[model samples]
Target: MHREKALDAGLHPEKIRVEADPYVPIAAARREILEGIVTQLRARGRVPRVCRYALAVGGQEPRHSLDAAAAFAVRQSWRIGVGQSYTDHHGAAESLTRPGWCLVRQQIRAGYADGVVVVTHSVVSPHIDAYKQQLNWFGAHFGFVALVVPEMQEWRP
Candidate 1:
């Protein structure tokens, strides 16, 4: 399925553009896609444009993955803007403390002309559910949040 269709399925915490690495989970595909994009752009000596869709969130491990992936991408080409996290004021007290969503929301507020490219882990931690809700809410409010999950040919219909 194409990127648009995969997103329309409404599978929360969807995985997109996964790599075949044994250590990597199928859920982390979006990060893989970002990494791949970074690698490709570097190879071509070109800078990637700002992707407003970028969202780095979820469990601590996932957040780490996002950091690593974005760092890799940024090192290659600094033109890209990566949104790291968001924090919802109305969310639970624990949710408010976590820095996951705050980083991402800051980037989103920074503005982008070419749209955003969100890179998040496949699974959502309990602490991240509120953040996740924010993502869904943002999508609902803006009407252009696209979910991209990368499935192997064996998994794809």
Candidate 2:
């Protein structure tokens, strides 16, 4: 801007410095971004605990989802307690027939888990309202729900 303005004003060459480096937009790493969110939540007392949380995996690929959630948590320096993992095999999240999902909520409600992590929103609910309701429940309990997804961070149910 300085160089541009000087040039526009027809200032002497000696009065101008080289143009500053061009701006470059660089997206943050997934771990860094997620850690920032967790830090903010902790500072605001929105996080149930510092590290302890649970996992909720629903759908046909239970193993895949579970691995994603676990790996994400580990990367974020989050911890999942023993037997804190739950899964609804080949089931629909909206159906609410997922015992695994129910157990995760139970753990949160009981204050045993600070939050729940999923591989995607579909692991929680496919419907917008349903997902919001789930988020509301977590908010009410001063807990959180995290999703493991691509770098885009644009994924939504």
Candidate 3:
């Protein structure tokens, strides 16, 4: 359906990359994130015997399932030990105040995983200022990196 719509909209089929919607409960998004992280780590010659990772997803409600995310990580040969979801239920919380965000920070601090896999950069907050602050905080506080999966909007398809 998406392919046909893109074709009708004058996008070449070859150029239409059908990416999984990160905002949906799809395992593909998780897989892609894991793959990208692994690739990045490999390029940096930081291959650990086992890739242990934690997941942090942000939204008023979970856009993806933790079980599916874990399974996807396992399928990629990664061991996901922690998973958390953050929500602005009342729409009145800062990025740093989210329980899930705090859990992620704790996991990193405690050395539970090599790094975190965020569903998107917006997992911190939708506001640009908040996002920048969150990124800076992660960089300054944690020695390891936090990898964000590519959002669907990046693809023209």
Q: What is candidate 1's CA lDDT for residue 151? A: 23
Q: Estimate each model's TM-score.
A: 0.30, 0.59, 0.47
Which runs of model 3 end up more than 4 angstroms from their true locations?
A: 1-76, 82-92, 143-157
**Cα error, candidate 3, residue 2 (Å):** 38
> What lDDT tens digits, residue by residue, belong to model 1 across residues 6-92?
676567556555534431343243344445654665588855554322223342234443454456436544454433323232222
For lDDT, candidate 1 versus 2, the one ahead is 2
lDDT of each: 0.38, 0.59, 0.48
Q: What clash pairs does model 2 have?
A: none
Give the count of colliding residue pairs in each prediction: 25, 0, 0
TM-score of model number 2: 0.59
Residue range 46-152, candidate 3, lDDT tens digits: 64222222233343244453444445445555555423322334344775776665666676566555455544545546565665565555445432333335444
Please give the range of 10 consecutive residues that has the lowest summed lDDT in model 1: 143-152
Worst 10 residues of 3 by lDDT: 48-57
Ranked by lDDT from best down, the candidates are 2, 3, 1
